[model samples]
Target: MELTDNDRSIATFTMLAHAVVHWFELAIPIFLVVWLDAFEVSVAVVGVVVALGYVPFGLGALPAGLLADRYGPKRLVVLCLAGTSVSFVTLAVATSIYAVAASLLCWGILASIYHPAGLALISTGVEDRGTVFAWHGIAGNVGIALGPFATATLLLVLEWRLVAVALAVPGLLATLYGLRLQFDPTAGLEGDSESDTNADGDTGSRAGSAFVSNSRTLFASSFLLVFAVVTFVGLYYRGVLTYLPELLGGLPAMEGIEPPAGLEELSLGDYVYVGLLVAGMAGQYAAGKLTSRVAVARGLVAVFVGLAILAVAFVPVSAMGLAAIVLYCVVLGFSLFAIEPFYQEAVAVYTPPESRGLSYGYTYLGMFGLGSLSIAFGGVLLDRATVGVFFGTLSILALIGAGLSVRLLTGPSPTDTEVPEPTAADD
Candidate 1:
């Protein structure tokens, strides 16, 4: 199937906006310690704050998706991006920890909109959805990689508030530009339609009733399982990445650094540490490509298993160990993103198109809500133990997640049927 001019344009805007919003969304986590140092907060407090931002991602994600269904994915995305931008700018003006905490809540809510709406849009825009989703993952990674460098540079030259405001502006502009994008409403362009059946079809009365009933049934079971998996995924993802800097800082290799003037002060190793994130980007993109060639569940199992092994490998701590950690990180990127396609595809299979946003919202809620706890737990663990111990714990969690992912292989049930055709009625 050929992409219409409109499809290409919407897809381009969607991917670019996704990247920018994600960049700002993820930037804070990588540099949480900087905020704590700059504001005189503790690591535990920072963990709480970091986790709070993610809470809305879980709570607001489904609502955002439902709203997208009611209105349009494109419009919800615009709103989410703009809202996130404004919320982040609030961080610029924060004078106390409470203020920052509040800002994070707002940011989480806004950041939550991307997955369901954006993924649905991409699913609608392209026939080869794996490719679209792959690009989506790549876009997010681009944002993720940019976060550390952007935050680090800004901290060097300006206050964090100024940096946040700068970050907010781009999202605001993207939101406005998105407002003007034209799209096919029935074709998953508008929010409430259940099927892509043509306007001329007289079988609506029969199909609509059955579709609604089936959707409700499918949604219940799928929601529980999806929620469990996504929550675990989010928790693991945010937990690991949020603690990455701290983890690296505490490594035996890093113990050699001369005591710096302040924790906020950059270390020579910080630059090298940033490069590890770059490897994550490479890993994610590579995994995205590989998904089309293999089963996503199998790929996830491989990545997590490797991570578990490597996490344990780091216990010995040597040059080989460091290389193993880097290898683990690279594979982590691949595994993390590889899992997403399966998730998205499952949503497509299990959820009614009308409630797709809701499906995403619930899944994101698990990811963000439960995941936030994981982040805090990571911090607590770090406060109490060594990097090897913390990562080793994460590796075990990864193994558990791998086992749970096996459920995906059973495949989407019949109630999860997606519309086979894209038509004007889809709008």
Candidate 2:
């Protein structure tokens, strides 16, 4: 399909905004390692403190979506980038753990706006939603990989504070890009009718009733099943990524490896972690390409089944040899991110144009908000059970998601369905 200049511009800005938001979000984990030495706090304490910021990151998405629907998405995109830049700068000057925690809290609130706003824009503003979403997912993975990579690399030359200040530059540039960017409101919608509806209505009673009505409509729709599937995916995502490095460290292949003599003490596992994330870029691209060819439900089932197998295989493969472990990382990373575009497409398929922002908002709330709890849950499992048990649990979650995807397949394909409009019938 031939993309117009407007399509290209919206896709570029949307992808950049996604990358900048994730870069800031993922950078915190790298800093958590730094804080261990800089502040002399226990790991458990740091985890809880960081959660203070993370919880808001998940919780704020719904409101951010609501706001994007009220205002234009462009405004929220600019705000997310600019605010994140400021938050990173604030993190740069922090002298205490409490200050760091507070800065992160600020960052969380700011960064939370992007997923809902960016996805909504792409889902509704880009004509080639599949290709754009695929590229968007790739950009996100780049940010996910770069955030920690940049932080870790910069720490070798400068203080962690300086590193944070350096990290803010991209957000500042993205903010500027967002200022000049414009999107066609009707680009991805089925028609102009819904887009022309008065998104902002009267206050007081009208607002209250609209909110209640919207809530009820959402519950009554297939969006609930989509949310459930996304939630299961989130739990798997969080549990696996949060502990991946530590788990890789326990691999036999990494047992005797050493960092290069001139560098700081990087481990084999760290390199493996980076490699896996890099591999996910291919997965994102492939998934995006497949969106036009494969059915969403079928693709989700295949990806999740692969995830389940990988989850079970990770332990045994790590014990085999370095070659085997590397292969495992590639496959695991690919499956981990490959499901994103399909599920994102599913949201647009299941929801109407008017509620698309809120749909993405609640989708991310499942992906990030409810998913955040998996960190603690994974921790508890690690402490109480065998590593085998942990992988088993992840497999179960992926299978559950796959089961839900099968259920979705039994209904009308998202691609085949006409975009619905909000009306009395919906209420």
Candidate 3:
């Protein structure tokens, strides 16, 4: 099906908004490090603050989902964009560590408003859900790619506080653009003739008949295994995303690279670390195309296996170690992001369309919320263990996660699709 002009416009706008949000996500880690050093605080404390941003995304997913379902996703997206803009700006001005903490807490909560609502909007707006979602993921990955670069650039030219100010501008512009969006309620919810349900998982019927069936379908065993694998995937992905820079600094390769000007001398590579993230963007886009040609499960399994091999390639003492680090970063980017579409497909397979929103909310909670807790734990582990132990531990978990993907292929359920699964999967 061809997209109408309005559909194209909405999708373009949605992608733009999503890219802006990812910028803030990429900025926080590097910023946290700078803040810690500037304030003479411990790395452990900075880790806590960095991890804190993730809390609201998970905790607020349900509410964000509910708001999308009830009031329409458009408003929620606007609110989140505005909230992020305000929060990022406040972060620029924040002097006290407590103030930065509070701002991030708010940022995390507001950032939560975007994903479910933005995604739901995209799903509703486009006829081709898989490709649209893939593109959406690409946009986010691109934002993530640019964010650290932007931060690094600012750090090069100005004080860290000024860098924060520079970062806030894109978010503010995105928020303003978001507020002007025109939403067509009828067009977006076209296929959703099912009864409305809130985010809390409460059941209600439309006129006591049309919407109130409460028998939630239990997935076949394969779905459970798929879910479990995804959980570990989430943990590994979030953990690595949280710690890559510190890992670099801890390594021998970066011991010689000069720090960004005015920044304290550090062992971490001084180049645009954003390049590492951009490589992942390339991986995600490639994976998105590849998943459709092969089975999603098979594609994910290949990526995960690659992750394990990349982990084994790690050696804390040689130049080969640096090559392994770059390789694994790209591999993680490929596998971590490439698996998302398959996960979305699994949700569609396991749950009824009417209940899909709630199912997705729970799935994200597992992936982002509970997964975030796992990330926090990894930070704790990093505090106690060496960088080698950290990657080694994550590699083991990823291999285990890949093994679980086999379960997804074991049952009849995975091969069956009630909705038209993507034909020409990458197209």
Candidate 4:
């Protein structure tokens, strides 16, 4: 599809916004080892403290979405960028683990606003949303790859604190750029005002009823089914990614390679990890392209089925020789990230334009908020069960997600139909 100037602008800024937001979010994991030594704390303790930050990242989305509807997406997005920068600067001066926790907490709150705000913007603002969502997902994967890669590289010559402060620079620049960008608040809601009018042709008197109707419409079975599918996807995502490195390191193929000193030590298992995540960029693009041709539900089913197969294969493949291990990482990486755009697209497709922000808000709450529970649950499984058991559970989750996708496929499609504009109060 050909792109217009507005489409290009929205995609460019939103993609950059996605990259920076994820870069800040993922960079924390690289600091885990550093924090362990510096703070002299148990791994479990570090885990709990980090959860403080992550929990809010998920939970805050609902309110952020409400705010986006009331105040506008651009304002919340700019706040997200600037607030993330400040959180990093706070981290740079941390003197204790508590301080680190506090900074991450601050970071999580700010980071929470981006998904609901940014995705809402794209879904409502862009004409070619499927392509835009694909590029947006790729940009997020770039941030995911760059965060750890940059953190690991910078730690070679600088302390973790300094590296964090340095990382904040891009967010500040993005904020400045956002301040100048112009967006039409009603870009995607052109027909909404007329649709919202009552039989008598008055909108103001029925404003309250319109809100109730929209709320009911949002929680209807179709949207709810999609929500359930996305929640399962979130569970699978968090469960697998939380311990991927250790799982890979424990493989027989990775044995006997002497751990390097300093920054090189940080590079351990990273090549495979980064390679898989970087390959996901292609996955995102491919999924985007496929959705333009296929039904969203069919695309979701294919991706989740692929994910389930890969999750089951991961354990056995790592036990094989080096060639098999590389193959495992490549396919696993592609399958892992490829599903994101489909689910994102599903949310936009299933919900009305006026409530698009709210739909994405709840969507991410499941993805991040409820999804954060996987970290703790995964840790418990790892301690009490075998690697096969842990991965098996993830495989089961993926199957559940696939089952949900099948259900969605059989339901009525909600494909970007026009809806009434929200009343002033609804906004």
Highest lDDT: which candidate?
A: 2
lDDT scores of the candidates, listed in order: 0.65, 0.81, 0.65, 0.80
User: Model 2 scores what on Cα lDDT?
Assistant: 0.81
Question: What's the count of clashing pairs in each model shown?
Answer: 13, 0, 0, 1
* Model 2 regions lying over 4 Å from their true place: 33-45, 191-193, 197-207, 412-427
> For residues 302-411, what per-residue lDDT tens digits would candidate 1 score against the true structure?
76666566556555643444555555555555555556665665565455565555566666667766677877778778789866677778777777866766665565
Q: In model 2, where is the ten-residue run with the lowest total lDDT?
A: 197-206
Give the least accurate 10-residue stretch of model 4, judged by summed lDDT. 197-206
CA displacement after TM-score superposition, residue 269 of candidate 2 (Å): 1.5
lDDT by residue for model 4 (187-276), tens? 544543333322211223223565466556677648888888889888988888879987777777877676555544643475677778
Give lDDT: candidate 3, residue 140: 89
Residue 82 lDDT, candidate 2, scale 0-100: 96
Q: TM-score rank, highest first?
A: 2, 4, 1, 3
> What is model 1's C-alpha RMSD?
5.9
RMSD of each: 5.9, 3.2, 6.7, 4.2
Among all candidates shown, the one with the greatest TM-score? 2
**Which model, 2 or 3, shows the larger lDDT?**
2
Quote each prediction's TM-score.
0.76, 0.91, 0.76, 0.88
